[model samples]
Target: MDRRIFIKNTSLATAALALPKIDPLRSANLAKNNLPKWKGFNLLDFFSPNPKPVSKPTTEDHFRWMRDWGFDFVRIPIAYPYYLSIDRTKNITSEDVYKINPEAVDRIDSLVSMAHKYNMHVSLNLHRAPGYCVNAGFNEPYNLWKDNEAQKAFNFHWAMWAKRYKNVSSKKISFDLLNEPSMREDMNDQLSKRSAVPGEIYRKVAKAAAEAIRKENPRHLVIADGNNVGSTVIPEIIDLNIAQSCRGYNPGIISHYKAPWANKDPDHLPEPKWPGQVGNQYLSRAMLEEYYKPWIELTKKGVGVHCGECGAWNKTPHDVFIAWFSDVLSILSANNIGFALWNFVGDFGVIDSGRADVAYEDWQGHKLDRKLLNLLMKQ
Candidate 1:
């Protein structure tokens, strides 16, 4: 066996979860099946993909791109203020309606339907979720896992979504449980006590979220982006018998390759900017394998995995990104892990930003990254 396969096979056997007392979302999940065929894509940051004011064509063109690109699905990450009342400001005092927004529901349905029109599969993800997220001000509110109310609210978000989309189909749609749940203590005691311990809360939250989403739809693939500090710790996820999934964000390395996000995060993380610091010795293949090991291990053992997002920032050198992507796509396809590039076009646009009417470059001399189309279409 090749080094990658040998190492991953060994790892999967070690990470299997002793059957938990809590019923798994899909009862059949316990029975072995072929790893789900996943050739999906992710669209984020570009449109906020959130409930925020969204342009219809913004999503329309994106769906078109996925079809043309030969990708089978698209995973969407969105932000919602479920903790607050629908007025968009009031903190939920004592109301169930306080937990979700119908507008978010409506808009998201629109996007899902659009994808369905294209015959593309979909995974709707809560990106900058109620209180849990990497963005500084949004650290989860209560003891995320242990708290009854918080778990209820968290579970409600998916339960409600599943109620709406459960009939969509495991073939056409899936729901990621949460985006990059992590253990960051940067919030200076702002988040409530129970949710305070990062690792513990996240685990509890994961179980609850998974159970709830599964409540409404057992077959849909509900993924939990690895619980590392935020996609950096797939190895840790393997320990949890958590499905192998990664957000594929290494700011200075790829997406932030050269754009100016280094100090962008509030003080807690002063991660550097573009072409920032991926070590010179780090060839794309090495990076892909290291990042991919967890997923490879899971799938070989009959556990399904997904690469939720992967794309470089348009600000960085496109050529460098194209070269890196060649290896990343090959690994994902080889392993049968579904992936979504970060966006179609907008801030990190693949089409809309720099090129104006053209599909490639938005600026002079910087032609569109010709490799992008080929990379996505690769089998």
Candidate 2:
């Protein structure tokens, strides 16, 4: 189970299978724009909407291991509230949003620097923006899409980050404007009915934010998450010259499975099976291909695309997760699109994933899912 032994065993097993090496030039030709198919993981050190501790800090070992294992990118999905000094007991006012805490900023700066130190491209994303979040938990003073105050604050925060990393090269860093843009009936209700942000409104907000960022550094790369919680492509923003981000968790039934946050009644959901029946619906790779058609077409239009987050929770059977995820990665990789797993060391990662069926190997005191790691390395 040691790291070296695991690698040795995996290498021999892979050789026995006689898998072909990925052709670099062929992969490069699949991409339409300058975007490289960056493959890596999302580090959740600052992902919680609440300021309190939710996840641990990412260490240098993560970067080193990822680089050693053949990954070149890391997406840091941050919740704005994590870095701002605000009274969590009350709704955050526009003024309260600007109370920037130097310590939190320093911690974030360190993360960006550490990722760069290992030659990893960092894509900074606002998972929870000033006025909006897909999940329900915190109270917002104003609506991002309907209120002027929230829009202003959203632009302000992006502008601040733009200025903060203005000196960094676009090749090494990019900004994912927001995490999953959607309109929910109630911002504080987790189960609130949700829909995509109106195309015009989404375009307006993205345009303004892109302008703010460009003002600081015109060469800085910018990306927008797909409308409707990262599922549907935003045709409205294609002309904005900004890239778009898509999700990997299509057909929530598979990706989410028994995740409480994803389903209202996780207990009642049918057991998941790849390319097989689950509940009344039959799921298959053909369905996945249909789902990603829009995203793949977006690439043909010369718009850069990336799967910012993808991975199933630990509850799903390990074999099913691998089967479904392999199809997801294959579809994306074939089109020259890249992906980042939801995390690197938690419930949806290669290390310490906590899946019941996985035969975990030990690596630097962490339980490494060698099978999952091998699957990821192949693409």
Candidate 3:
């Protein structure tokens, strides 16, 4: 079935899921337990995946907490660089990992197994992907499509993953082809124009990965995110066929508000909002409508879309953060799409990296308010 046409014909509900927690656009069939019956989610790597565990990430502990939080799924961002080698600009020579580092491989397996133990849906994404990602700092010297070697290598990696996870069913796991693919090099120069380039590349890599996945796994949902990494940037790709994920944070605005690149960074202008405010840093319901309208349209057209990752800066007030999350989660719930917070805990992690309850509000564990969890758990 042609993805374009197939998407064109499906009712919007089957396509993208949203929250805002009103009457769901789609029917909310209660499970045997009669819960809200939404597709649940959690943002993975609450703290950065420390190559050195006990010292960095509290691996097993976080997973246990996720399960305890009642989240139904988890999305893990995995980068291949740990296994592959590129030159100074970090340009991937073959797109394939030259070494497939043992540590990286072990962590990947461990995360997957951890999710399985809890019966949570696991989404594997290629973050800071070899060829391209939003992190220009990490991109070194790579460009999508322009590098044939990278493209081929990317294809090979997907093929490898498809085969590797062939046995991992969607019931327990899924795969996001790549994190955020900038269509062109000058995304910040002129987002309006740069957005379109990624569509073709995404289709190429995503379809290749999907085909590879379907050939083996058969049921794992293959999701693809829109350009700008967020639904707001490119309205055109919103209705695209692949499953969708978006990076909703405003660069240096909220989560990255203070990031050094926000100013000099060409990708985005720094206009961060302060926390504990309603209209500024937090995304409101109307804001969600504007930001996610494209995703809604795509779902209307028949693609499985979801708000994969959305959260504010850890420095923000917990109450303010909760309000923002409340609003965003409500919007996602209304639509039935999955939502994962930026992290469960850590530097950029949900917990103070891995100290568990040791830190201040920064620690993911201490910061987790049961009230918030209960509210989110409500169908």
The most accurate candidate by lDDT is 2
TM-score of 2: 0.91
Off by over 4 Å in 2: 1-33, 53-55
Highest TM-score against the true fold, candidate: 2
State the lDDT of candidate 3 residue by residue for 262-319, as single tens digits.
3355345434333334333564456655765555555555556666676655454455
Q: Rate the local accuracy (lDDT) of all candidates.
A: 0.58, 0.90, 0.56
* Candidate 3: C-alpha lDDT: 0.56
Rank the candidate models, highest lDDT first.
Answer: 2, 1, 3
The predicted structure with the larger TM-score, 1 or 2, is 2
Query: Compared with the true structure, what per-residue lDDT tens digits does model 2 show for residues 1-379?
Result: 8999999999999897897777987666464744789999999999886767555568999899999999999999999989988778787777998898888888899999999999999999999998888877777777899998899999999999999999999999999999998998887675889888999999999999999999999999999999999999999989988999999997788888889998899999998999899889999999998998888889989999999999999998989999999999998988889999999989999988888899999999999999989989999
* Residue 129, candidate 1: alpha-carbon lDDT: 53
10 residues in a row with least lDDT, candidate 3: 29-38
